[model samples]
Target: MSNRDYSLSDVVALLVESGDNASTFYRYSDDVPMPSVEVLSEIVEDLRTVLFPGYYGPSEITPDTMPYYIGSTLDRVERHLADQINRGYCFVCDKNKVDRCQDCETRSRNMARAFITKLPEIRELLLSDVEAAYDGDPAAKTHGETIFCYPSIRTMTNHRIAHELYKLGVDIIPRIIGEMAHSDTGIDIHPGATIGRSFFMDHGTGTVIGETCVIGDNVRVYQGVTLGAKSFPKGDDERLIKGLPRHPLVEDDVIIYAGATILGRVTIGKGAVIGGNVWITRDVPAGAQIVQSRAMQQSFSDGGGI
Candidate 1:
């Protein structure tokens, strides 16, 4: 098969040409490989191994070999990340600036180094997450079980690491890292979401935590739960506003259960328990417990919205 252009504008054009109707096959427009996504995943996995030496990749790593291994991994990671960052810079930036793009490569390396320096902090945060999962679920046998097996913990770990890079302004790669976890774990957490400590997820498949969502400490979310946006308000240029908080504010100790979809900028109050398959657009008071009523049958939109 021949290659086709599938840029976002190209896709929009195709849809318009087809009278706003397109098949599932039509939805896929480009076969061009995205190497950056895989490279970002490999870099993150390398860091994960370095962070949890005995648990993630190689258990036999010793102090003697640790420096060599770390140095080697960092070397490989920097090269790959620099290439991706430069490519992304080339994509969204001015064409004239591309020829003189000297600083991006350096900036990418520096960001990678900064992320590496923060591994200890990542591990510390993950410890609490592991503990939270262990305690939150009766089925979780141990902290080891949570670390080794839980999909939510795995997804959250990647998000936490990627979130740091996202905050540090390394464009495009954080989403890649999060997508890597999404592919492996069936959990899609946006890299830009601000998650706090001791977050626990239970049976976390089909959970979509959107960008701009601010989750407070000790929040527990279950399968098919979505902390997402309402309607997107467009600006004067018809472009959706960038960097505004669009998703839900999930407060501390809230337990959002399976298939619950909370949208808009509504606050899910502290200690509230949201039940399965419920659609919530309005704010719930603290200590509120919301359940779905069978009397109200609405079409289930996979992407959560009211």
Candidate 2:
């Protein structure tokens, strides 16, 4: 082990050899190109430009020039998105040999076009989210401020775009897109989560919305709120089951305050108010208010009983 006895060539050869120990971490294929985080990040930015024209990408957009700008941006987005989708398809095919896709190019193009078709609807939903943020927060001065300054809108925009790709069957790209937003905003929303319009998250930091969560319209949540699973169901083989409804189902007009965690497939009924710093696992009735008992006692002691 002395420095004089060490051979650099031997060390390099030893590391380059793909033995059983090294096989798990290596991909030996060169036929399919891997997806690039840098390119996908650019694609997400271009899409955001198309989704909100005046805010991102190009700044000066007039009614006469908007169509040209949108068309050019969408064209670029579709091309890049198709390449990433094809990479995702090739990756899946390399992993699972049984159900290999023959024509990833055509499939990727079709999926990308289908996702593009969903842009108008996605923009409508995002506008509702912007309106929700403006109406729900007293500190918000204008809708433009929410669109430009709020992390919730940025996170939701990424979620909505990624959700469409998820539905269109573009596999790894959607999760990458979601993770990009998560890395940027500290709000983790799974692509598989079904969230309705007018969703607003105020001070949305450290919030985790698990897959299989179904949230209805006009739902407002604060920072440090978690909508997660209570337990994992195991089969006879002792492996955890996949794709089961494990997360909570939140109904319309629900307001979850900061530092609250709702677990399991329980329902938070319509018009229910979940107070701050509470943990809920069971279903709350419609119009019910759930809070900490100590907070309730303190409220009553202060002559502010509910």
Best by TM-score: 2
- Cα lDDT tens digits for candidate 1, 46-94: 8777666667878888889988887887778767766776555554444
Candidate 2 regions with alpha-carbon error over 4 angstroms: 1-19, 294-306
Off by over 4 Å in 1: 1-35, 62-68, 94-100, 293-306
lDDT of 2 by residue, 222-296 (tens): 999999999998999999999999999999999999999999998888998999888877787777777878866
Error of 2 at 33 (Å): 0.9
Best by lDDT: 2
Report the backbone clash tally of model 2.
0
Q: Which 10-residue span in candidate 1 carries the lowest summed lDDT?
A: 296-305
TM-score of 1: 0.79
